[model samples]
Target: MSVTGTASDIASSESVPTSFGEFQPVGHVMVGLPTQGNVDALIDALHEAGWPPESLLRFTPGQSVEELQALVEGAGPLAGFGYEITLLRRYLELARNGYRWLLVKVDGTDEAAAAVQHARACHATLAVHYRRLVVEELL
Candidate 1:
């Protein structure tokens, strides 16, 4: 399915991540889909499930690869001390393989669970919920 909405309606300002550190993307679920079609469907499903448009961010493979490259290049020594770096590498690999991404803002386990349901329905290849001190794989 093709994405149907204005940029503001379908994407958040944080489409490009600021960093790949341990604390980055806390309170969000990062979902990766194998195709643009899956990404578009997941966005629609999330909206129908009452997730606000501003809480969703979409990233193309190109954008994902570019941002990840910059983040990896600028990472500090401690970046390797956590699973964040490993996750970043995985995301980079997926992006290189043409997977798209959706970053959804979630308040807690309940919200993350809800998002994961839609992600699963839309065939998301990866879904990771970033909590305050833990990264939980939801799919």
Candidate 2:
């Protein structure tokens, strides 16, 4: 129920753990959206899907790294869904190149599913994979 892949060791000789269960952030989901145009509908859809206004983490191009980091950190870990920090950083890089991203964490299975469905209906992207927490145990 865990993966041993390091952020910098994607090709390293290590065991890649995998599992399915009530994983960490078990009921949360992240939504990606376009940064331009009218996003009010998408935001409204998210709220209608049970996501609180305070749970949204919206990032746009030209946003400073510190600002984005602060927003992500403020949303806390569970809201990160299954994306690793490295991957999140990569997302930021993409954003800098004109890709807008919306990151959110809904609080339950129904709500997460609703959000995902609504996102897809609205043409936004969704990520709902279960991520195992990587912990190092020395014996």
Candidate 3:
């Protein structure tokens, strides 16, 4: 089951070809989050691209992804806030034109799809559907 689409095309068009099975450091897929802020819509995009719901589970090459996962899953107080702050900081950095997309990665073959899905699954629970967005994955 492979996802084939323009979002996928962006990744595919890369002079370097990658697969949806494993991910390397800085190896990520970027998706255009909906301007409307709809996670389901993003999921639909992932579905269209053929990426698995839990596709962000595979891995490869380095401690970065793991560290990120630890930071995201921090059991300490204000863990969620920590991530929000980081994301917001990144957002600001990007606004300031100091953004590095590769720092935050989506290791799925269908990067666009994965990114959309990941963005959508930002703040929910297992019952809600956005819980899996923070987990690190490889492709």
Candidate 4:
């Protein structure tokens, strides 16, 4: 899926998920960087590594904070029973601290692996792959 635009654009287009419930956002990886500069560098590195710009969506700290807060508040009661909720809370904390996020669409394991490599190289603070059945933390 070729989704090109700002975080708001992609989020509204439903190409990038605005929230995570149980087993949600399958086939994508969310990488969090400590700063906008780091996120930009990661995006550049990802492009150099063969990922198209269309496959990446960036979220500034303000956007992330808003989205994450809404996600937690709107989640179902059972959401508290899952690790997804915990991760959402953690993401909220990071967002509040000025961390930016990149949501990458990955078609398979190879793509996910490559994304993780680039994320680490760019000093990503967190990298989580949302698979069909599980959320795997890559860093």
Candidate 5:
């Protein structure tokens, strides 16, 4: 039998260890997070390290494709902050549950490092964000 609920509930449930223990990681881990004032701190850190504020883009899955495309293309010279059409489609499907997403592109490891540091400073938890982001999609 199968049971379902919000990702947080599923993830935190006692049954998860038994039910999902068979799963294994397929590759190295990468992480992402959302923040409050932490976003400003991250932006500042990135900019100090040479990644401009324009290097980040925010999108919600409910947006139309045309609207998404226009927003990406309309960035004009600021386009290609490493965004891909496929990412939009993936997020569109993944983020239907009122989760806002931020895409970050850093020119170097230093910027990436700073971003993570800022996220940690803001107490961002990717797992919780992931849960909120996918609650509707899973149901």
Candidate 6:
């Protein structure tokens, strides 16, 4: 879950998020779009946010290819924005397998203010980024 490389690597991306310093991967992301319209919004938003394809992990309990693809498309708006967002799902093996908490594991260097700002932007109540954690909802 730790994608630690170099700063040069992040800066080199073509279309990068302005919140460059905030760029960091966390545990995982769980999204279930029950409708096509919702999927479109997510896709459009993700595209504008600059999400790296390799950074995402997906799962669908019982969804068709088309349905999954639509959700994937929308996920683009949420990636590489310097935030690692993971979802804990019910009825999933990982959840029952004892992976209850999605720990925000960091592997980089960044400022506190920057981290908090990134969390706010993502509307994340508990956020961990770039080796620094601004919120701890687990408490």
Indicate which candidate wins on TM-score: 1
Whole-model Cα lDDT of every candidate shown, in order: 0.77, 0.45, 0.33, 0.77, 0.34, 0.30
Error of 1 at 85 (Å): 0.5
User: TM-score per candidate, in order?
Assistant: 0.86, 0.51, 0.26, 0.85, 0.35, 0.27
Candidate 3, 30-78: lDDT as tens digits: 2222222333344445555555554432111132233334433443445
Worst 10 residues of 1 by lDDT: 5-14
- How much lDDT does candidate 5 score? 0.34
For candidate 6, the 10 contiguous residues with the lowest summed lDDT are: 6-15
- Model 6 C-alpha lDDT per residue in residues 48-137, reported as the tens digit of each score: 444343432222223233332332334445452422323211213332332211112223333333333433443333333332344232
RMSD of candidate 6 to true structure, Å: 14.6
lDDT tens per residue, model 5, 24-112: 11111112234334434544554564544445443323332333444334433433442333333443343443333344544344444
Residue 107's lDDT in candidate 1? 92
lDDT of 6 at 98: 24
Best by lDDT: 1
User: Residue 43, candidate 4: how far off, in angstroms?
Assistant: 0.6
Question: What would the per-residue lDDT of candidate 1 be over residues 59-98, giving only the tens digit for each residue?
Answer: 7556777776666656688887768878888887888988
Clashing pairs in 2: none
Sorted by lDDT (best first), the order is: 1, 4, 2, 5, 3, 6
RMSD of 1: 3.2
lDDT of 3 at 111: 57
Candidate 2 regions exceeding 4 Å error are 1-27, 64-83, 126-139
Candidate with better TM-score, 2 vs 4: 4
CA RMSD, predictions in order: 3.2, 14.3, 14.8, 4.0, 18.0, 14.6
- The residue-level lDDT of candidate 2 at 127 comes to 51
| Tens digits of lDDT, candidate 2, 1-139 | 2111111211211211112211133234544455443245566666665556656545444453444454445444554564444455554565555655444555545555566667677666435433234311110
Query: Residue 93 error for model 5, in Å?
Result: 5.8
